[model samples]
Target: MKNKIIGVCPNCGANVVEREKGWFCENRECRFVLWKDNAFFKRLGKRLDYHVADKLLRDGRVRLKDCKSAKGKTYNATVLLSCEADGRSKFSLEFEGGC
Candidate 1:
């Protein structure tokens, strides 16, 4: 089966397609990608699933309702998506009331 088109590449304006291991920009020169088993999300006790990935690509942010802290406390936050100079994805969290 052919890969599904997920969104536009934030770096190169190419089509972002879903692959087995990750979502990737179709432009050969673009390094933009979102790995399914991303270490960043893993650290937050979350998997980078399709819904979150789609929202991040389309809106550059997604609200995570139950993020577990290292100490096992659950909290809600908005995850912001940004691109690095090399087209790699970078993420940060925004918490309510300066958490």
Candidate 2:
């Protein structure tokens, strides 16, 4: 089966590999990792957070205003995220790229 590679690393411009532990960027300088847990959730925001930023920084290849990687490629997009109805919580990437 073709593994659905979601996004790209925003740190070192490398592809992020999904592991049982979490996501990992295949870059020496970009050692980005994320897991699903309490502490992980605590370090995030309602709509978006550090985890989201980390994901974007480690697997989000974009070039927009509300985006992080603005030096790679220019694409119109509006990413939507969802998570527990709380303030400090890790959210999931719901929407990505429509324009």
Candidate 3:
């Protein structure tokens, strides 16, 4: 099956396509990618779905509701997407009230 075009790579402005294991940049030399089974989201008891991925690519951040913590508590926060020097995606969480 052909991979679906999800978004544009923030790194190289190439098409970002969804693959079996992850979303990848069409430009082979670009390292931009978003893994389907992203470890960061897994730790938050969440999965990185297309909706979230789209927002991250388009806006550089996404507001997530009802994220589960390791302690089983739920909270809302914004997920920020940043690219490393090598084009790998990195994520960070921002809570309300500056906490």
Listed in order, each prediction's TM-score against the native is: 0.95, 0.37, 0.93
Q: Which lDDT tens digits does candidate 2 get at residues 1-99?
A: 643344565444566565555555566555544443324233232223344544454433212233323354433343332223321223333335434
Residue 22 in candidate 3, Cα distance off native in Å:
1.2
The list of candidate 3 runs beyond 4 A from truth reads: none
lDDT for each residue of candidate 1 in 20-86, tens digit (9 for 90 to 100)? 9999999999899999999888878899999989999999999988889999999998899999999
Supply the TM-score for candidate 3.
0.93
Screening candidate 3 with a backbone cut-off below 3 angstroms (N, C-alpha, C), the clashing residue pairs are none
Q: TM-score: which candidate is best?
A: 1
Least well predicted 10-residue stretch by lDDT in candidate 3: 43-52
After superposition, the stretches of candidate 2 with alpha carbons farther than 4 Å from their true spots are: 1-4, 42-99
Q: What local distance difference test score does each model get?
A: 0.92, 0.41, 0.92
Worst 10 residues of 1 by lDDT: 90-99
Looking at candidate 2, the ten consecutive residues that score lowest on lDDT are 80-89
TM-score of 1: 0.95
User: Which segments of candidate 1 are over 4 A away from where they belong?
Assistant: none
Model 2: lDDT of residue 86: 28
